[model samples]
Target: METTPAPAAPARRRRSRAPFPVTVTQMPMATCQVCGRALAHRKGEVSAILTAHYERDHPELLGR
Candidate 1:
């Protein structure tokens, strides 16, 4: 007797933007307080970075 073949799995949809989980220990490269933009360039002025409101709601700056 011939065995029946297994059914094929459903195809997954390709995503342009994928959701991911991040750990707390991982420090961001560069943070922008105004627009909440992650950048490579460091902020020269401490006051500018600290005083500006970050859209992303950076938790690292909470205590400091």
Candidate 2:
């Protein structure tokens, strides 16, 4: 006698929601004019820290 084959399982249904892309904004940081290093500041705004850094790092360039 011939045997019958079993039926295959149904495919699963997935959610229709699509994934969203994320974006980020980067602000530029201030750099020290004397040593060419990044200066410490907040919200992309420079303060007296740059001046103090220049005076302490390169006082010879201040007079020129």
Candidate 3:
């Protein structure tokens, strides 16, 4: 009697799906109700580099 070995199966390759489209909605400008002035509000920003240097080097100026 003779024995035979089976062939190995091929590996599958996965493909990524396409990204969704992005659309930006425009917001209207705000106006001040009092004093009849065009109002613009800016959210606060902080810099770690500047704050660290100022606090470390100029501790005296902070109190004054």
Clashing pairs in 1: none
In candidate 1, which residue ranges exceed 4 Å CA deviation?
20-23, 26-64
Evaluation by lDDT, superior candidate among 1 and 2: 2
Pick the TM-score winner: 2
- Candidate 2 lDDT (Cα, 0 to 1): 0.74
lDDT of 1 by residue, 1-64 (tens): 9999999999998898967987655333555645566654344654444445442365556664
**CA RMSD of all predictions:** 12.4, 11.1, 14.9
Error of model 1, residue 43, in angstroms: 24
Tens-digit lDDT string for candidate 2 (1-64) = 9988888889899979887988866655788765689865667356677777777888888873
Cα error of candidate 1 at position 7, Å:
1.9
Residue-wise C-alpha lDDT for candidate 3, range 1-64, written one tens digit per residue: 9978788888887768777899976433344333244333333322443444456666666673
Compute the lDDT for candidate 3: 0.50
Task: List lDDT for all candidates, in order.
Answer: 0.57, 0.74, 0.50
Indicate the worst ten consecutive residues by lDDT in candidate 1. Answer: 47-56
